[model samples]
Target: MTQSTANFKVGNEKLIKVLDGASSHLRGLLEKQGRPDGALRIAVIGGGCSGLQYKMDLVDGPRDRDILVPSNAVNVVIDPKSALFVSGSELDYSDDLQQGGFKVTNPNAVVTCSCGESFSA
Candidate 1:
């Protein structure tokens, strides 16, 4: 199936809510850093014990083949390789005292480690 064909049981409204929440925090961070030019890139790499890991970084430039997912306020870029692993993923930001920040909810995951940083495909 195509990358976009991956099904997300979550409703669009809810997905947008989560995306919006993430955008807000990212934008805030960029603003505090003086509004650099570029997008926040999210990627899943192979390294963690579970064999896959999630990572986020601010990229001032995007190479060709980067997938762009734009919200009303933010643009999220993911490399094609990573796109395959996170096709149906939703990124959300949490500010809870215990655990917080950009949390990726990936339906493609078969299992995730307790730290929520690694997963099995």
Candidate 2:
């Protein structure tokens, strides 16, 4: 369960990067949930106003077809199907007054909702 950030590359391409704030937040959640070895799973599911929604959760391990991206002290797990939409995105954490939570800055998104929870590629 110990991985370095430099090991997050997929072939010759770099996968998503998790900012320090997001990694800290996720690590705290895993500790609180008593799953220090758990990983954060990010997936794209059909729903939301933009037709595709990003779903995230803490899981004990990666599922079949998952791409493991390590960042700092946390590991981000994304399924292959979801990776198509989230590739090159940054997993960030924000505490701004307007919006405060985990956010995805996706370059592939054609349109993203104001809430930052859903998008279309």
Question: Which candidate wins on lDDT?
Answer: 2
Top candidate when judged by TM-score against the true structure: 2
Q: What is the RMSD of candidate 2?
A: 5.1
Worst 10 residues of 1 by lDDT: 7-16
Q: Give the TM-score of candidate 1.
A: 0.77
Q: What is the C-alpha lDDT of each candidate?
A: 0.71, 0.83
| TM, every model | 0.77, 0.85
Per-model root-mean-square deviation over C-alphas: 8.0, 5.1
Q: Over the stretch 1-121, how does candidate 1's per-residue lDDT look in tens digits?
A: 6534332122222222237788788888877777555567778888887899988888654556676666646767777777778777778888977677788888888989876789988
